[model samples]
Target: MSKIDPKDIQKRMDRISEIFSDIVSHAETVSKTRCPYRNRHDHCTAEFRCRNQQAAETEEAPLVCGHEGEFDYRSAWESNPLLHARATKKLDEIGKAAAKRRADARRKKTD
Candidate 1:
């Protein structure tokens, strides 16, 4: 095998880093105003609620993304950690309760 130059490796890595930096910068800017959970079909796929989510005409259909992408959506999302602390706390509690039940079941089986 031919010996590889360290300079060549560094140059390729630098190019890749530059390209990814540009892509990440664009994504960050776009994500500020766009809802990531909105699919290409303009349907809301998020499990949590958002002010920008609108019910579909038919109950069975997925919720539609009502956001026009004109404003930052973080303020309108209930999934924001600061705004939904209680829900997060409750989920943690539920997880602990489920773990306890599982442990109790294992103990009963061992007995």
Candidate 2:
């Protein structure tokens, strides 16, 4: 018969929303960086050279590069304050939700 606190639910929903928003925004940046490794124009100049311009184009994963880039979201997220904040917030929200769910289940079993 305990009423769920509106403020608490709002906080949970807000946390989830922020995480999802950040994930989406960062994902877009990752995608933008996924251009063809080898273009006639030769746009990319990262440490990991894009030699995939010939008949066969093979590009290494961004993680292979020492620098943070669009392909390497983990690195990007780490370096970018906004991205880092978003990722951290998202993780905290997930953890909180999981813990809350566990406690709710326990309460239901006991009830």
Candidate 3:
């Protein structure tokens, strides 16, 4: 096999890095206004509620995204029943863990 040139390898690596950097930068800019749940076809793919979600024309179709990428997408993630339940479950786990820690500390103090 022919010996690999280090300069050629370095140049290729730099080009690859530049390509990735541009892609990442564009994605970041798009993310600021575009909802992460919105698909390329402008459909809401999230299982949770979002303020910008509009019902599809037909029942069989997925929900359409009403967002035009003009506003912050963070606030659009409205709470749904499933999301609320998930949050409640996480809180319960945290509370239980804290209570166990406290009980263990008390037992150590007494012993």
Which residue pairs clash in candidate 3? Answer: none
- How would you encode candidate 1's per-residue C-alpha lDDT over 1-111 as one tens digit per residue? 999999999999999999999999999998888888889899998768888999899999999999988888777887654556677789999999999999999999999
lDDT tens digits, residues 3-103, model 3?
A: 99999999999999999999999999988988878888999988778888999999999999998888897687867657777988999999999999999
| Candidate 3 vs. true structure, TM-score | 0.69
Q: Model 2: per-residue lDDT, tens digit, 61-94? A: 2223232343532333324345656877899999
* lDDT score for residue 75 of model 2: 36
Candidate 1 regions off by >4 Å?
78-111
* Steric clash pairs (candidate 2): none
Tell me how many residue pairs clash in candidate 1: 0
Candidate 3: give its CA RMSD in angstroms.
Answer: 8.8
User: In lDDT terms, how accurate is model 3?
Assistant: 0.89
The lDDT of each candidate is 0.89, 0.56, 0.89
Residue 96, candidate 3: C-alpha displacement in angstroms? 23
Comparing 2 and 3 by TM-score, which wins? 3
Worst 10 residues of 2 by lDDT: 47-56
Relative to the true structure, candidate 1 reaches a TM of: 0.63
Top of the candidates by TM-score: 3
Better of 1 and 2 by lDDT: 1
Q: What pairs collide in candidate 1?
A: none
